[model samples]
Target: GDPGLHHLILDVTQNGVTDHYQLLLGVRRDLPDRLLHVEIGGTSGDPGLREGPDVPEAHLYDAAHDPDLTRILLDDLAAEASVGPLRFRHTAGAGIRTDLTSLPITAEQSNTSLLFGDAYICKLFRRLSTGVNLDLEVNLALTRGDCTHVPAVLGWIELEPGRGARAGGNGEPVTLALLSDYLHTGADGWSLAIASVRDWFAHTPPAGDDEWAELDASAAGGDFAAEAERLGAATAEVHRALADAFGVTTLPAAEVHAMAARMNAELTGTCRAVPGLAPHAKALTGAFLDLAAQAGPLPVQRVHGDYHLGQVLRTESGWTLLDFEGEPARTQHERRALAHPLRDVAGMLRSFEYAARYLIAKSGTVPPEPGGRLETRAHAWAARNRAAFCRGYAAAGGADPAAHSVLIRAFEFEKAIYEVRYEAQNRPAWLPVPLTSLAHLAT
Candidate 1:
């Protein structure tokens, strides 16, 4: 092997504990090797090199961010070439140049995305899973269906299963990365919403109750009502495309009851995990009970399992949704399973609540003294945007989310329960955000 970029799978042992790791290293013939990146769980399902005294200490190198290496990788994919155990798959469409410079998008948490000269973005999955990734699968489907709400899928990279080693116990290739057209002018919905909230907050003075009562989100300069509505429409369009591509199904009464039971079980488990939720558990459980009582069959189809403000982008043309992988904490089978589209609507509504109250949460202050001016303005902002979003969804040929109040409320409670567990374990400070929502539901 020549000195350049290399990917190694290693079984590292420390203090009698062993773990698999994937390391992307930069190597040189005459100089010390460099470690570009490392993933805790190695993508390779095969046994790898064991750590020993002979292991070498490597220097650091940024291989994915290197323009030359990125170009080479793109060229390989364009040529449909197999380099070692890796296979490149390119979609037939517009040709992507291999001469562009590449830089890493640093804001990502679960994956690494490299932007290539504003023309394309390549997302490299950190953890490898058998079967095609949901993001790649859904994006490709949307692209084939001519859905304009998503960026075009250029191609993807995969790791071929090694001989005599079934990929993660199944004889399937593992998806490594996805390449897509980059929206150069796209602004993320989160940033836009935060700015809108900031503007609204500035307009709202920290004054007496009378002045706060007059504060209106629509009157604020950075009102997000219009954008939120358009986003809703765009979301409906994408859902339609998904339903067309991957057929829809109806969950019968039994299944619907089972779904509600699952939600109840989750709520109970979460309350047990976080005792602060105990006071509101009885009230929250009623939403699920109402859901279980529905006699009608409910429609289910592929949905953006994890929909939120951060998952959307506002470009010059309109709203573009990103990341179809769903909730990262869920199993692959669960994420791929069909669910009610209102599940996504509920996710977005919860996001509106987060955006409206995030500034207050960030300030480390108690939730605006429970009905103070700040609290009033936050509620108004969230309510306005939530209504606008539902209006846009209904206007765009989708069922009005508000029309299915029972399902919507149940889903929102389910999402909030998940959030409660997550914040309690990871971020105690942010726990108040979901707690506040739970309180409102309880009342």
Candidate 2:
């Protein structure tokens, strides 16, 4: 059955003279008359944060305040929903919070759920791509593989509206959002991980007289060795499932070099924007390109483009991977491209770095450099867990260590460059992370 339409969107594009646009809406495919009714805005484009629904028919009013446009979309959804005015709603715009800084979730995390909370999450992709999201495809594959750490995929929804990207270069249904069961998180991987880090620092003696934090070397509580190993083991399992399901092969040097070049250009751009980061940025990007030159006969398989602690959850049984969705900011195409397993590893390491900075930033005591003090802990944590994640991946996918090691290091450098760009753009206060990270690369 088609996804029941609850919301409608008419991308309003107009010159100064005439303002008109057709509204695309969600509807029950079977029902013709019924529409999902949801109350969103009053007059201005702005609506309150919390939304409420009056009935199943969610309407979309035009900018000029045309109630008829809302009615038309509602009718379309009702027709599509087919369950006879089924109780459902599709929101056009989920109100953004001004002080969302208080929330642990980021703008990127909530993009899908906020609109599809009642029934399903249908992502309306901006940049076009064909077929299904790999996160959706791979996760389904893993669940099909019956891997315990991965969640079971219910199903997938693609735009049967057909290949629109080829026709007029616009206007067709796309594989917008892949819906899955949202994991009810108890404790995030970051908190659980840092607990181990704190325990380690607590046991180890301070390096100097001014040192206040403890340094415990105990692997039992803070060591993260066992868990890291377990994580590695699980990652290996995921990779194994991926290989059996997708198989592995060597990528052409040109393709690898192209990717490496893109990464280098991006990193150099980041450094150029911030003179402070020029030195390390140059070295890191330079090393990343140099390493990319080393690739040959290495296998490329389906990989979690963005794998990290925050992307996973720990339950009573073990660690469960979350969000098959790659970096939300990336295009669906980029997310789907086959790459080194190290891409995921680098992402996890970066995740650790993010967690460390977040902990300190939360305390209002920002680290002078990223990974300077807290990363000391994060590096320990990441290194330990990375090995664990690898063990898991190797066992599961049988990844070659020699090839994987090189690929992973290049990925790590890539992630750092990404961080450098990200921090410089949004949290300039947190730019220290990429700065210090670049220094490590140079040394």
Candidate 3:
């Protein structure tokens, strides 16, 4: 039986120059489907004055999304007024306020975060965690380091000691949401890559055009190699900024072996969850074992734990990296842990393969044979872009990811297995995408 979590409303506050929507203990289990849903609501009174449980269920669950609530909160925060114990702070320091009426509200991704008109985007940390939000932390760090690859952070919402209690004992201030400048002219890297792939394939020779049958990817009008190279360069710059901001470390052999073991465990778990990948498990073991044996002189540092095409944006300036929240499934500590920089490189490389394959599927034309012209075209495009990206990365003062083939391959396989598990559970139709990589990399 599948179950889900649902939302429950808790309390609402309306006071002089301040309106706060407080959602505490609002998570309930939907047993029928086995899915967890976040609940949201508030009683029409002063919750702070008379409190039973400020946050319910021994852990805080903030999953309510109401534009009206956000508007009132922003209005009060911009005024810099103390709405009970909750204080609104911004990078601007003082007297910076946002008007709810002036800014239109737009929802993003299941309505977890919101856009305040065209000027600002507010990201609410739905599943409440005790520590400082990694997104806010990373953004502020990058911004302070003058890293132009990320959007500027404008402000954030925080709940102080007396407002409401969080998971950890003492009521430490918990970050609720972060406000950042919206990129009006920015485009997602994934869509851009997909479009490039479509453009490259557009000139493919029709069925019997033997003369133009196999056009080299470099010769294609929509070649994305240059863009990919530039993006790689941008990525390297960001990595350098991160290294500067948070000093780098070297993972000893023991830790490297441990990392490889974790990869093996992840692969095993993925295989258990997705039986389709079971056949390739044997083939994949060698990569992990080799990684464990050959582990040495690994440079580790804080990285964009969840780097992919979708995590990047292309603006007039250049490639802008976004989302430093790391992997959502992992804890904040794990996400903040230092690791090989090649992890991100591997993720981007996989993204290239995904874009090429997705475009091929969308074209809805297959070659006559199994490993025919279509397959070759897709591989060639991905390979060309992947190579260009590595070249650019190496040129930009980073170790070549390809130089650590075994480690990179293991990381790619780990990422693919994770995707396989995700697809099998959430989107079965997308299972083939990662499965294709699984088979190719397993050998």
Candidate 4:
């Protein structure tokens, strides 16, 4: 073990469940020791450790929250030093510097992002998994290709496995952090979409007309059609760049059948976990079965596996996509597997549906009638944006996503099913959002 570096385990208990976290501390002679990073580590059930906090170990300051500690980390990155088991790799031609202030972004859920002045942002992965992180891999490829739709990748930190108590039990190194150009004024697509929905809901019809019938999303002040179209175009551009960077391949008909089979298996498991999905199982299964029956080879490529409104930002220049790391619940192998680009398109379309219905669900505004006024307006908004996005995608030289109706519909159903399970467990009130989507698809 290094003299100034220590690996400490912190256990936090909430609701009778204890979770373990590994904290990497860097000690200095005259200054406070800094918490270099934290990750989810292996659990220990030793009862003796539960009684007291270890001396000095619990007194470390977070590098992300403190400017001094952040500067130390930056200095190491600028030097491109291999500190203990961590290796810093600065991108070629990157102007690495250390004289910058740091501000920790608090809104991130799965990872911590530290903003350096106004120029760069560094994202620290909290979960240690083997292999190159998909986000880092895709960003680097796009940045090197000079893609304007994504932030430029600057550098990254990688941790060698089988080092000290933090060993991930594999020989391959795992990505610890990624540094990239920051978008200071870029607003997240989710916030923008919600505001659009709110504006639409707040609209007042002219006098002497049927208010509900006359209300139109396009007529609303915060209409998102133009942005949605541009976003679609940007998404297409990203897909093209990814195809060029990673190389595209075709999935033979036999493999497509296997893919469909995997989707069916996922559906079965989801149905078992969420009994509410059982009634729609038969109809939902039809989508996968139809996917299997398709003939000829299907084109597949690296894609934004977890594409959604939240994964994009609307900047002054244009839409900037973020987070290429697929669904977190999936294994590394699954996240890296090549898939149809339409899967991403489907995810974005589903995201529009979510944006439209989320407010209605939160406010308990759904009318007793099946096709009530609010419900109708929500559907109209989602439909308009979805159409605009597809139009932009086609106009940007990509194949018309709508032309591949079978594949898109199946992918939508697959995403909706995953959402059904997610919302069921975490957001019971929001369950209707995906449930309604499944019901529409089931029919």
What is the C-alpha local distance difference test score of each model?
0.80, 0.54, 0.71, 0.79
TM for every model, in the order presented, reads: 0.88, 0.68, 0.79, 0.85
224 Cα displacement, candidate 2 (Å): 3.4
Segments in model 1 whose C-alpha atoms lie over 4 Å from true places = 1-3, 9-23, 29-62, 161-169, 205-214, 364-371
How do all the candidates rank in terms of TM-score, highest first? 1, 4, 3, 2
Residue-wise C-alpha lDDT for candidate 3, range 1-443, written one tens digit per residue: 01112222233335642222324232232211211233333332434522355533221224233343356656756765555556677775434446643332443442256666677777766555554667888888888888999998877777676544532313667677787878878989888888777776665454554533555787667778988999999999999998998889888998889888998898898888889998888867888899999988788888999999999988999999988888766766788888888899988988988887785554354333333565566666888888999889888987788677888888888888778888798778778777775655566
Give a tens-digit lDDT track for model 2, residues 1-443: 13322322234445653221222333231232323233232312333311433323323321112222323323433233322322222222322222111111224543333222223222333333444545666776787677777755543333444333331123434443343444554356867777775565445445663452332334445566576666666666676677788898898877787777887887778777877867676566666667677845556888888787876777667777766667755765777777767677668767756654455555544434333555565455545565565665566555545455566667877787777777778788788765655554456
Candidate 3 Cα lDDT to native: 0.71
lDDT score for candidate 2 against the true structure: 0.54
Return whichever of 2 and 4 wins on TM-score: 4
Which candidate gets the maximum TM-score versus the true structure? 1
lDDT at position 62, candidate 2: 19
Per-residue lDDT value at 223 in model 3: 79
Q: Lowest-lDDT window of 10 residues in candidate 3?
A: 1-10
In Å, residue 22's CA in model 2 sits off its true spot by 14
lDDT of 4 by residue, 368-387 (tens): 33346667678778888999
Lowest summed lDDT across 10 adjacent residues in model 1 is found at 38-47
Off by over 4 Å in 2: 1-5, 10-39, 42-110, 114-131, 156-158, 163-173, 176-186, 198-223, 363-379, 391-404
Give the candidate number with the greatest lDDT: 1
**Candidate 2: residue 223 lDDT (0-100):** 66
Question: Can you list the residue pairs that collide in candidate 4?
Answer: none
